[model samples]
Target chain A: MVEFTPDEMMTIAASRLLTNDDVCFVGIGAPSAACNVARLTHAPDITLIYESGTLGTAPNVLPLSIGDGELCDTAVTTVSVPEMFRYWLQGGHVTVGFLGAAQIDKFGNLNTTVIGDYHNPKIRLPGGGGAPEIATSAHQVFITSKQALRGMVEAVDFYTSLGHGTGGNDREDTYGVKTKGPTVLITDLAVWKPDPETKEFTVVSIHEGVTRDDLQATCGWSIKYAQDVRETPVPTELELNTLRDLQSRTAIAHSL
Target chain B: MSLQDAVAKYIKDGQLIALEGFTHLIPHAAAHEIIRQGRRDLTAIRMTPDIIYDQMVGMGCIKKLIFSFMGNPGVGLLKRVRDSIEHEYPSAITYEEYSHSAMANAYEAGAAGLPCAIFRGFLGAELAKVNPNIKHVICPFTGEKLAAVPSVQPEVSVIHAQRANKRGEVLIEGIIGVQKEAVLAAQKAIVTVEEIVDDFDDMHPNTCILPHFVVDAICVVPGGAHPSYSHNYYQRDNAAYKEWAAISADRDLFAKWMEDNVMSVGPEVFEGRVAHLRGAK
Candidate 1:
């Protein structure tokens, strides 16, 4: 029996959702790691696109950012920023958008804006890059983040990216968003899937160590569970080793 | 012309200037010169305002920042930018935020000489509510409501490229962003290149070459995009980004590092720092 950290479990779980044929718009940090893991292990044909204009990037190491030179060096091709956003992203060619946010609501709306007040914020977060388009344009979105009561809020202070846009097809009905909004929320403790009708996030599976009550306490909204909640599969040895190797390679590449 | 001369002649105080680079070929050397010359009250524009902008904001060289994303790339929040916004440390620098697509289209419109850029975005987001500059216009053709923002036509644009011919035409090879559009849109453009070759010999099929007529001036400055990478010239200095997180987190340390590395030295210091990365002596 092997144990893995929650971060590792969450990353592995997210990687499992990506298929070989999916064309994904990859963000930095955890999202990048998950996409890279999928490419290295199972999703070899996954086309990785970045906002920095690199299309079909096949980096040897995890990119430090969207603009990391390795992406260009190992990319199948690179396009202009306008062509990337207009033709590739908004043109509805992307299949998946992998993202991370500072705050997310039950409706799955993401906030990367301010914390307290927009006029005068307590903590000013880094604003959205390509999230607005990615959230609404991609056929589906996969969000990963650490779970806590503060992070999983009743409502985000400011919506930087549309998840379900207040749930219940509001994203499509009100905003005319073309794609199905966020399908899954992979967290350190649990995996959430939106309710088909309500579009609110509900826990479908818990990690190896977390409990139903633990999840309830951590979430800001009224929590619902699948009829028979299952435990997320423990990380396989191969998955663990592959992930660690990627991390080590990234460290070496960055000389950290 | 020298980088110093370019900055002095082309860049003016209180002008809206954009140093456009997606990730590769950022004009870090030109930015350092702006700091060295003590330019003030200028509005800085970029799609992703990275460490170079952070350094400029920290040094009080900017009065406002017009950007889509503000951060130190993969590391974390830009400490100096945060301090300037939150505490008004050096000064209270105002900002106008947009999504990546909006900025890209805005630059495109500028290049094409349009008054404003219109795109289908910000339908359900909070950006339009707070930002008065973000407007909406009903499409006459489709009667659809779409977002609009003024095109970003900078007074001057500074950028770095892989190489330039002796005739002052610039060539960029890999991961080209809006550098072409930005240069074309600016009233005046200053370019820094790795080398000034006799002529571009059979350029890459995908490469973009800015004609000398479009470029106002060109300076030969090797390793000009240090910390950021120039395609075929150097790799991004990831360690520098990590190191900057700590240094910019504190004002005293940021000032000390800037003084030691940037203000105290000339642009010539970048010449040989990345020769090994380029596979050259």
Candidate 2:
């Protein structure tokens, strides 16, 4: 019998969404792990960019943060942060932008800023880094997170990064964002994609052993299922092996 | 010159100081010097206030923090910063927040001697609601609304680099954040280098080099960006940061760690590279 942790399954799922030749602006944490997993296995030509000014960074192991020295040592080149945002990101060279959020709405809008009311907040989160620009400028955005009832909310407390901005074509019309906002959201329970017109997320697939009821219990809002909703492929032996190897390397990198 | 002398001379009480390093080559040794000397009423600025800022805030050095994002990086929360902001432990420190793009653009504007930076940002975010400094102005040319922020020129900028020549020209290798803009915008700058060389090999493209005239002082402090990293020199010390999360959570433990590791040690405490990432590259 094959076994895999939800974290590993989530990472493998996220990595599979990426393809070779995609210039990905990698965020730290889960996004970094997923990008490295793709680079090591499937997407070797994936140019990993970081907001820390690293371009085409190929780390031997998953970096602890974007600022890790390994990012610089293995990188093809480094640019200034302003240049990264202006020329590379806003200049529309990035193909995919990977992100994680504290909370996400059905519209795929994200909140990494605050938890409760703005003035009197229950929890003050680490504000947005380069997420707003990345969300708007990247040709496509892929979000990954552990599916929890609190995370998949009806509306994020604060919209830190614009996804579809109330669904429909508001992101393009109102915000003047040129790129498609939040193409897919990979979660532990299932995969979601925005509708072509409304832009509301609908569950397109569920992971092995995860039922629609499980997603319903975990998701904060009443989610809509795709008419063609199907079961996501189970993690292959090779994917599991590659992902585990990458995690081991990451452990060694952090230990050092 | 020593880090102690550099800090004593350049940094002062009630000054807006920016120790700008995104994640690489943070001036940890100089930060420890500021803590050791007990400088007060200082407003420290950075894009991301990591463990070093946590240490300074815990020790009651910084009166305010101007930054974009702050945390322990890969680790969870910055216990000290959260404590200061939430519980007002040691002493509550005020903070002004800005997005990463806004801060970078503000620094760029400051470097260019501009009064403010106007950019296409903060359209639908909640940051504009809280931060009074973030304002919206109508573009004269297009009649579109744009966010504007004042230039972020600091009183002094302190940074770390890979090397410097005897002529005092500093070379910053990998991941040059806003160090260049911060230094140029600052009234004065202090740079600490891993080593001082006679002649820099043909410099790499996109490398940031500060001429001697721009740099107020250059001190050779090997292993300066310890827990953080100096690219090609040493690896980031993750274990220390893990230890810091727990140590910084408790006031007494933080003080003890500082006394044992930072306060007691002099600039000579920095030995050669602890763990070089690129082995003989």
Candidate 3:
């Protein structure tokens, strides 16, 4: 058994959620790593799309930016940005929207816009580039973020992307969004899913060696555990080695 | 024509100008020329407002910024933009923000001569609450509500491409972002290219070509997209982008860097900056 860091474990867990049938709209950092890892390991035929208009891209190394030359060079086809957004994303062809968040709420609403007040911000985050549409337009969303009290907050400063609004039928009833906002959240400590009734995220699987106290300490709100809480399967040797190789190749390519 | 003349002729003060590129093929040289020529009170527009806008905003060249996302790409915060918004350094600038889909559709609508862009976005986001520009309209066909924003019709659009022919037909290859929509949406367009050939032959069939008629001027500036990249011409300067995060953090250092790098140099220096990265593809 190969030892994996918490980040690698989280990535592997996230990657396992994806299958070959998913046409994933990938965000740049953790989601990109997970999607690529899944492609290399189990899901070889997963169609990866970047917001930079690369369709069916298969880069040897991870792209430093969404529009890195490698994405285009290795893409099956590259379209205009307007067409990428209008036809592919808004046209509702994507199956999964993989995203990251600066702050997430109990309802899985995300905030990547600002920290404090909108008029006078304590920290002005990189505003949502493509997540807003991807959240509502895709069939479903999967979020990955390292857990901390500040990040896993009770409510976000601003709702950059709507997960379930205030739970229940808020996604479809209140906002007219038909897609499942956030189906699963893969964090370092646990795997969470929204309650079918309330839509508030509840811990379903705790990673090996992580305690309920560990999850509660990092989460802002009171944590909820599922009745059949299970241990997340550890990263397989193939998953660990494949992820490491990808990172090493990415480092070498980006260092140039 | 020279880049200097083109910038002076097409770009004006207090105008809505879009320097459109995604992460790839950004018009850094043209932005430098705009800075060197001292254009002021402009409202700059882009989808990702990459480092070029950071410099323009830091230099006090812009009074307003219309963008979806403003960041240093793969790197972290755009410090200069953060400083201006958080601390009001240089001067307080106004902004109108949108999601990337809204902005892209707005540009598309502008290019199509539409009044506004209507799309299914901002469903439950707070951006629509803050930015009144993000309004709602019911789709007449489905009776469903959709997001609507006014089309972005810029006075001028500037971009960098891989090549252009002697007839001034520009070719943009890899990651052909919203540059085409931006150019067509603008009243005037300026394009900088690596070189001008007699004709484009042996090129990929799907490449985007802006015809000579739509383009107002073509400047043959080699390595025009330094720091960013011109696809098939040079690689993106990731080091420079990483270095900018530190340099743009300080006001004095940013000014000095701008003085030494942009204001003091001609477009010719761009070619030398990317000499090692040439033919990187």
Classified by CAPRI criteria, candidate 1 counts as medium
- Assign candidate 2 its CAPRI class: medium
Please name the candidate that would achieve the greatest lDDT relative to the true structure.
Answer: 3
User: Which candidate order results from sorting by DockQ in descending order?
Assistant: 3, 1, 2
Model 1 achieves a DockQ score of: 0.69
lDDT of 1: 0.89
Docking class of 3: high
lDDT per residue as tens, model 2, A1-256: 6898878888888999888989999988888888888898888988999998889999887888887777877889888887787778868899999999999999889998878986556787887888877887789999998899889999999988899998899987887677887999999888899988899999998898888789999999988988899888888888889888878988977786
What is the per-residue lDDT of model 2 for residues B1-281, given as tens digits with 9 covering 90 to 100?
78888889989999999998888888988898999999998999998998989999988999999988888887867778888888888898898888888899889999999999888777666777788999978999999778899999999999999999988899988889999999999999999998999976687664678889989989898888877777777777788878787998788888888899888977767654354443532
Candidate 3 residue-wise lDDT, B42-84, digit = tens: 9999999979999999988999999999899989888888888
> Which segments of model 1 are wrong by more than 4 Å?
none
Positional deviation of A103 in candidate 2, in angstroms?
Answer: 1.2
The candidates' DockQ values read 0.69, 0.64, 0.90
- Top-down TM-score ranking: 3, 1, 2
Clashing residue pairs in all predictions, respectively, total: 0, 0, 0
- What's model 1's lDDT at A79? 89
Ten residues in sequence with the least summed lDDT for candidate 2 chain B: B272-281
Cα error of candidate 2 at position A112, Å: 1.5
Which model, 1 or 3, shows the larger DockQ?
A: 3
